[model samples]
Target: MGKFFYARVSSKDQNLARQIEAFKKMGAADEQIVCDKESGKNFNRENYKALKSALGLRAGDVLIVKELDRFGRNKQEILKELEYWKKREIRVMVIDIPTTMIDIPKGQEWIMEMINNILIEVLSSIAEQERDKIRQRQREGIDCMPVKNGKKVSTKTGRPVGRPEIKKPNNWSENYEKWVKGEITAKKAMENCKLKRSSFYKLVNEE
Candidate 1:
């Protein structure tokens, strides 16, 4: 019965203020604006749900959003919400670059409406698939890169040049002599020796 506009931003770093400003330029009142600041992978949203509950939205009530992806990334969820609006004869306006056109279908115009819905579904599917491909490519790129700031040691290559020397621990005699002579405690001796409790005990048993 009234104009309902919804906007969304994917993260806290993003702002919905621009979207609200645009909607205001279109003559929507402040109270008519609804928003969400979260990922659009799904439609389970507090603000989005409130917008849906205000339904039975007549033929002229319009739904506005910043962009399609702002509405949702999941193809199925996007298609589902759009279809809901279409069925109720509610118009949708997307405020992208040139702003969006709102075309409400009636009578034989339903054919064009059906075609447009089909196009929206096809395009949403392709976008989601392309995003998946790009993410996979980036992950593969990271895994293939060499470990940085570390050595790739080998007998043929020797120690990697300029890398710091890594010390190996001494045997039980040195550790026990240091401890028994009160030069160090058992704990400190074990740590400096870099041996486990069981290994330290084995060394003590040997002497």
Candidate 2:
């Protein structure tokens, strides 16, 4: 049976060194480990997909991860992936969960399965909840930013923050008038104004 490891981080800037080192300590070769520097919010990651492909994993193989949360933050999706591997006769081992890393007696394997189910349910829910909390915090932070003259301002320096407002193009009036009168297509007007669809519509609404 082959052994493989999967590691993930939430963003490109986040480090994967710790997870890689842990996998190395477990005797996984560099080629046996797949890493993704992307969010765990879903299972659409590139490296993760490659790891789950027919060429990478097979029945009787073992898939190892540093933690269950690293596998995914979506509870239902995480459970679905687990079920997929289970049906294929592949073992998924999470290092942080001691029980999952242990071997059970052949005849009593059901006991371990029951315990694993309970732990997975609880931990996956917690991971999903944590992801929701993080999103809420980000929204709150944006809402709490001070606004000055209709623009968001930094709390420290009272300076305008975030994206600068898009200004109307010099030829906007002429192009927009033509577009409104059906003399020119919206796409043509946008091209003349050098603005994208969203920006063109935003300018139109403002006018």
Return the top candidate by TM-score: 2
| Residue-pair clashes, model 2 | 0
Best by lDDT: 2
Off by over 4 Å in 1: 54-60, 96-100, 103-106, 130-207
TM-score to true structure, per model: 0.56, 0.78
- Pairs clashing within candidate 2: none
Q: Write the per-residue lDDT of candidate 1 for residues 1-207, one digit (tens) a residue.
A: 578778888677887888888888989898888888886778898888877774435676877776677777789888888878878777776665122354434665667666666666776787577657766996775555555446444334454433454333546567678899999998988887887777677667666
lDDT of 1 at 56: 30
Q: Write model 2 residue lDDT over 38-58, tens digit each, in one string.
A: 888889999889877877889
Which 10 successive residues of model 2 have the least lDDT summed? 155-164
